[model samples]
Target: MNILVMMKVTFSTEEEITIEQGEIVQEGISLILNPYDEYALEQAVQVKEVYGGEVTVLSVGPKRYEDTLRTALAMGADRMVLIDDPALMGDEWIVSQAISAFAKKERFDLIFGGQMSIDYASAQMGPRVAVELGIPIVTTILEFTMDGQCAVVHRDMDGYMEKLRVPLPALFTTQQGLNEPRYPTLQNRMRARKKPIVYYIGEDLDFSHEDRQVKTVSQEFFVAPRRSEGKILHGSLADQVKELCDFLRFAIQ
Candidate 1:
């Protein structure tokens, strides 16, 4: 099994977000692997361990993202690919195009990624890549098992579990409950520091001008206003209901 895990570097959720002049302040914020992508990478490594194959991690971001890629390698991936190109960086549409281009050149039996990136939360990268590759895809999968050349997966569908059997050469986006990620050992971390990471520039990929065009015009960031304290109603049930209605009406007005 040749598995490719798509990963991303995102802002750490533990840090506080600050906006200055409609832009996020990134001077002192920490960056880590996308939380959801950790599950995808863990699943890929486990599959490789059981089936005896290689796992490769792929990401598209600036050179700073190499640190996150190194962490993925320590976790169990064999190698990494970093597509570091300013022209190729854009919205999800353009990023997916770049990923699909690279994936099209390589052969992978299975492609895995998170249900959504923590930063964007668009939930479009995996499916978009699958669409570009003309492969089958199942999102938000909680459980996955191999059945010969097919894969059986369990997903939540409107509070009900839906079982699916997909053929090989497909894509799957992992959800939160898929599996717990493993920590890297001291030996693996040492080995990861020596692993090779291939870099790709925009000129190397096959992309037209239209494909590189960014669809998003502008984005703004602002802090949410503090919520007001709740008010208590001291009276009978009818009076409380009347007071609540009146309060709501006044607020709306």
Candidate 2:
């Protein structure tokens, strides 16, 4: 089983992120692997433990992202790939296009991703990548297993727990409930420090800055969305209830 774990670099906060000339500002901020993707990688490590295979951590980002991928290697991935290219900054679909293109070349057996990235929280990248590759995919999965030549995925739909079995060579977007991610032990970190990384770049990969070019650009960079002040209505319970009701009625009216 050749497992490809797709991860991403994302900011830690939910707000209007500062962009210096269309690129994310990173002066004093820390960039971490999307937590959901961390869970996906941890799960991939576990799968390798059971199935006897290699875990290849893949991320499409700038050259600086190698540090994060090295961290993933420290955690336990057998190998890593960084699809470093400036044009990947276009849009999510472009990033997906680049990854799916790379995946096609590898003939990997399984692809995994987190339910969503922290910053966007749109939960679109994984499915989009799968679409680009024309592979079957299941999202928001809580757990999964190999059953013969199929994958049995468990997920929560509404309030009910549901299980679906799909064939191999599929994509899965893992939810936080999947499994607790493993913290890299000292020994693992030491080993990861020396692991060789295979860098994937623009020259060899067959992808263009064209094709659904989002034409997306930011006008300016800002901080967290401005918040409004809340007024507190304080008084006796009965009086407060009446006041709140009066305020609502007045506002609505």
Which candidate comes out best when scored by TM-score? 1
Per-residue lDDT tens digits for candidate 1, residues 70-174, read 999999999899999988888888899999999988899999999998877999999999999999999999999999999999999999999999998999999
lDDT top scorer: 1
Clashing pairs in 2: none
Candidate 1, clashing residue pairs? none
Per-residue C-alpha lDDT of model 2 across residues 1-253, encoded as one tens digit per residue: 8999998987666544566666667756777888899989988888899988899998888777776677788777899888777766556777787788789888878899998988767788888988888889999899889998789999999999999999988999998889998887888777887887777765557766564365455565555567898879898999999999999999999
Local lDDT at 109 for model 2: 83
Using all chains and alpha carbons, the TM-scores for the candidates as numbered come to 0.93, 0.90
Candidate lDDT values, in order: 0.91, 0.82
The TM-score measured for candidate 1 stands at 0.93
Question: How high is the lDDT of residue 232 in model 2?
Answer: 90
